[model samples]
Target: MFKSFAAKAIVPPALAVTGFVIVCCLLLYSVIKTDMLNDTIRHETNLADTIIKSTRYAMLKDDREMLRNIIGNIGQQKGVEQVRIFNKKGVVAFSAHHAEVNTIVDKKAPGCIACHAGPVAATSMGRMEQARRFIDARGRSIIAITAPVYNEPECFAAPCHVHTAEQKVLGILDIGLSEEPLQRTLATLRMRMTVFCLMILALTVGGVSALLQRNVLMPIRELWEYVSRTRRGETGLKAPVYRDEIGELARSFQEMAAKLKSRDDDREGGSDPPADR
Candidate 1:
C-alpha cells in the first residue's frame, strides 16, 4: 500500500514539484540578484551626482556656510553615512559627524590623488565627482563620493584672494554612507522574492497534480476495472463515463467488451461467428 501510494500520490507530483521549484528558484535568484546589483549601482551614482551638484552650487555662490550646510544635509539623507569637505589646498575644511574636521586629509585615501591631484584630475578635477566604497576609521564599510571645487576667474580681481583658472583649486567634498543599510535592504528583497517564487511553484505543481488525477488517472482506473470485470466472464459490464480523452477511451473499451460478449453468446448457442470475424 505504501509503495502504491508513493507511486500514485507522491512520486509524479514530487518530481514535478521538485524540478519546477529548482528551476524557478534558480531563475528568480539570478534575476533578483541582478536587479539588486543594478539598483545599488544606480543609487550610488545618483547619490554622488547629487553631492557634486550641491557642492558646485555652493562654490559658485562662494557661500562657505551654505556649502557646509549642504554637506551636513546630505549626511542626514538615507544611506548617507558621512560627509567631508576639503579646501583647495587639500585641507579638511568641514566634516559632518567626523571628529577630524579642520584637519588636513591624507592624500593617500583611496581615489583622493586620482580624483584630486593626478593626471586624470583635469577631467575629474571639476564638474564631475567620483564615488567608491571604503572602510572607515571604525572599520565599517562605507561609500564615499569625492567632488572638486573650482575657483572662478572673476574672483581673482578681488583684493582678498586672487582666483585665476591656474590657481583655482578651491576644495574637494567627500560623502560617505554605511553599506549596512543597503545590504540589509537587498537581503530582504532577495528573501521575499525567494519565498514568493517557492509559493508560486508549490501552487502550480499542486494544481497540475490534482488536475491530472481527476481528469486522467481516475478515469483510467475506472476503465481498467471495467475491462477486468469483462475478462472475468461478467456480462453487462459498464465502462466509466468521462468528458475528455478518457471519455473517448472508455467508449472504445465498452464497444470492444460488448462485441466479445456477443461472440461468446453466439458460440454458446452453436451459431457461426459474426461475418467480420
Candidate 2:
C-alpha cells in the first residue's frame, strides 16, 4: 500500500515538471534562432554594400578589366559565393565566373525580380530594393544582395563613356554569400541548448522528488507503521509530530488510541468487586 501511494505522489509532479521544461526550452530556441538569422543577414548586406562602393570608380571610368578584377577578387573570399553585374536587358555584363558573362538571366528569377518588378518599374529601381535570399543548385543556402549602379555625373561626363542623363540605373550589382557557416553555428548552439535543458530537467525532477520524500512520503510511511503496530495489540504507540495536515491527522489518531486505552482500564475497574477494600 505504501509503494502504491509513493508512486502516486512522485510520478505526476515529475511528469508535469518535465513538460514545463520542454515548452519553455522550445520557446527560447525559436527566439534565439530568429535573432541569429537576422544578424547573419545584416552582416552579409554590409559586405555587399562594401563591394559596390569599391567598384564604383572602375564602373565610372568604364574600366571593364578593373571591374572584373575587383569582382573576381571579392568573390574568392571565404564567405562569398559569386558576384556579377546584370545590365538593363537582364544580360550578365560582368561576372566573377567569366563563363556566366553575356548569359541572359531569367526575368522571373529572384535576383532579376528584385530590380525588375515589371518592365516599367525595372527602369526606376532604387538602391534600397535589392536584397533577397534563395537556395542554389548545389543545395547550399545563399543570401543575395543587390546594389544599383547609378549613372552618376562623373559617369556621364567621362570622355570614355557616352552621355546618359536619362539612364538613372546603369546596372545591378549582385553579391551572393554562403550561409553554411551561419547554419553550422546555429546547429551548434541548438545542441548546447538541448543539453542544458536536459540538465535543468534532471535537476528539477531530482530536487522535487527529494523534497516530496522528506516532507510527505516518509511521514506517511511512518504513520502506517504505527497503525499496524497498534492493530497488533501493541501498547504505548506514539505518533510523530509534524507541522502539516498530516501532523494534525497523527495527533487525532493518538488522541483516539489514548481514549480507547482509558476506556479499557475503566471497564476492568468496574468489573472488580468494589476494588476489594
Candidate 3:
C-alpha cells in the first residue's frame, strides 16, 4: 500500500500527527484533573471553616443538642457526605448520623493516624495536610477535612464553659464531601478533549496531504506524461514553468531532443543524391 508516492508522503506525517495529538491531550487532561481535585479540596476546607463558625455559639454554651441539630442540617446540603465532632479523647461528641454519636473513633483510622500515630502527636497541621480522601462503608469516595477546634479566650471565658484554660484543643470537626460531582466534571472534560483532538488531527493531516498533491505530486505526474508523449514521436510540446529541479530536468530533455533532430537532418542530407551541377 505504501509503495506509491502519495502513500509515502502522507502516511508518515499522519502517524506523527496522531502521536503528537495523543500525547498533548493526555498531558492536558492530567493537568486539568489535578487542578480540579485541588479545587475540591479547597472547597471542602472552606465549607468546614463555615460549619465551625456556624456552631461556635452552641459550642460555647455547651449545648450538645443544638450542635447536633446544626451538624445534621449541614449534612443535608448537597455534596456533604458526613459531619461529626469528636473530642480529644477520641470519643464522638455529636454526629449528623445520630447512631455514630458516643462511639469511640480508632486512632488507626485514616483521618486520625496522620495526627495521632506518632510518638509525639501533632499539635498543629497545615491546611492541605489536614485533608484526606477515603471510601466509606457504602463505597462512596469522600474528601474529608479534620479542622481542630482550639480553646480560645472567649471559649474559656463563657459562663457555661467547663474546661480549664490548659486545654489547647477542645475537639475536632470532621466533614466529608462527596467526590461524585468532581468525577462527573472530569469525565465531561475528557470527552470534550477527545473530540477536540480528533478534529485537530483531521485538519492537520488533510491540509498536509492537499499541499503535497498540489506542490509535488501533480508536477511529477505531468513530467511523466510529457516523456511518454515524446516517446510516441509527438512534437511541439510546451515545457512547464518550474523554478526548481523539475524545471532543470525539462530543460535537459529539450536539449537532448534538439540534438537528435539535428543528427537526423544531417544523415538524410548526406544520403540524398547530389543536385545536378
Candidate 4:
C-alpha cells in the first residue's frame, strides 16, 4: 500500500522485526510467569514445612488443641486462604475452618488426585506436582499445595505409639494462597514490555527510513529532475551531484545534451551542419 520507495524498502524488515519482538515478548512473559509461579510454590512449600515442623511436637504429644490453634492462626494470616490437615483416610482431622473438621475430603480433588489417582497412593511427590491453581468461591485466583506428612521416627516412637514402621505417610497438609499479587505483577510487566518493544520498533523503522531517504531517494529524485528538464529541451540544466551510479548517468546525459546543442548552433550559423560527423 506504500507509494514511496522509502516505505517499500523499510516496511518489510520493520514488520518482520515487529513480529519477532512480539513472539519474544510472549515467550518471555510465559517464562517469567512460570518462574514466578514455581517460586511462589517453592515458598509455600517451605511454609508448609515450617507449619509441619511447628506442629510436630503437638502432634507427637497428641495435643489436638495446640495443633488446631497453630493451623487456625496461620490460616488467619493475610494471603492465606486456608490451612488444613487431612488424615490418611482422606478425613479432615484439623482445619482452619471448623465446619470442615471430621468431614471427608474429596480424594479426587485437584490437590489430592496426583497422589490418589492410581491403584497405589503416592507417599512422596515433587514440589511442582504438589501445587494446583484454582479459583475460590469468591472468584479469586488461588494456589494450593498438598504436603505429605511423613511418619518419622519420633512420631511412631511417641508415648502413645499408635503408628507402625510400615506407615510411610501419616497425613496431608493442604494450604491455599491468593494469586492476586502475582497476577498484578505479571500484568504490569507485560504492559511495560509492550511499550518498550513499540518504542524500539519506532526507532528502528524511523532510522532505516531516514537513511534510505538521505542516501538513495534523494539522489534518485535529483537525477529524475535533471532528466525531466533535459527531455523538455530546457537549457542551463543544473547537473545532479551524486557519488554513485546517478553521478555517471548525469554526466552521460550532459554530454548528449551538449552534442545536440552543438549541432543546433552549427545549423543556426549556416555552417552546413556536418552530415553524420
Provide the RMSD of all predictions against the true structure, rounded to 1 decimal. Answer: 5.5, 4.2, 4.4, 2.3
Candidate 3 residue 204 Cα shift, in angstroms, is 1.7
Per-residue lDDT of 265 in model 4: 96
Best by lDDT: 4
Per-candidate Cα lDDT values, in order, are 0.70, 0.79, 0.86, 0.90
Q: What lDDT tens digits, residue by residue, belong to model 3 across residues 1-277? A: 8898888888888888888888989998999888888888888889888989999988887888898789999888888899999998989988888898899989898998999888867879988889999999999999999999999999988888787799999999999999999889888988998888788779777888899888888778888888788778887786565788887787788767766666667778886433323
Kindly report which residue pairs in candidate 2 clash with one another: none
| TM-score of each prediction | 0.67, 0.83, 0.84, 0.90
Candidate order by decreasing TM-score: 4, 3, 2, 1
Model 3 alpha-carbon drift over 4 Å, by segment: 1-24, 232-248, 265-277
Candidate 4 ranges beyond 4 A from true positions? 2-4, 272-277
Whole-structure CA lDDT of model 3: 0.86
Question: What does candidate 4 score on TM?
Answer: 0.90
Return the TM-score for candidate 2, rounded to 2 decimals: 0.83
lDDT of 4 by residue, 83-197 (tens): 9999899899999999999999987887778888999998888888999998977999999999989999998888786888889999999999999999999999999999989
Q: Who is ahead in lDDT, 2 or 3? A: 3
Per-candidate clashes, comma-separated: 4, 0, 0, 0
User: Lowest summed-lDDT stretch of 10 residues in model 2?
Assistant: 121-130
Residues 1-277, candidate 1: write the lDDT tens digits: 5476325665676677667777877787778766765566567667666777766655666677887787777778876777787776667877776577778877767857655475544534322336566787788888666755555665555555546657755666676667786678767877886777677667766777677777777777888888788788787766788888878888887888788778878999999869774
Clashing pairs in 3: none
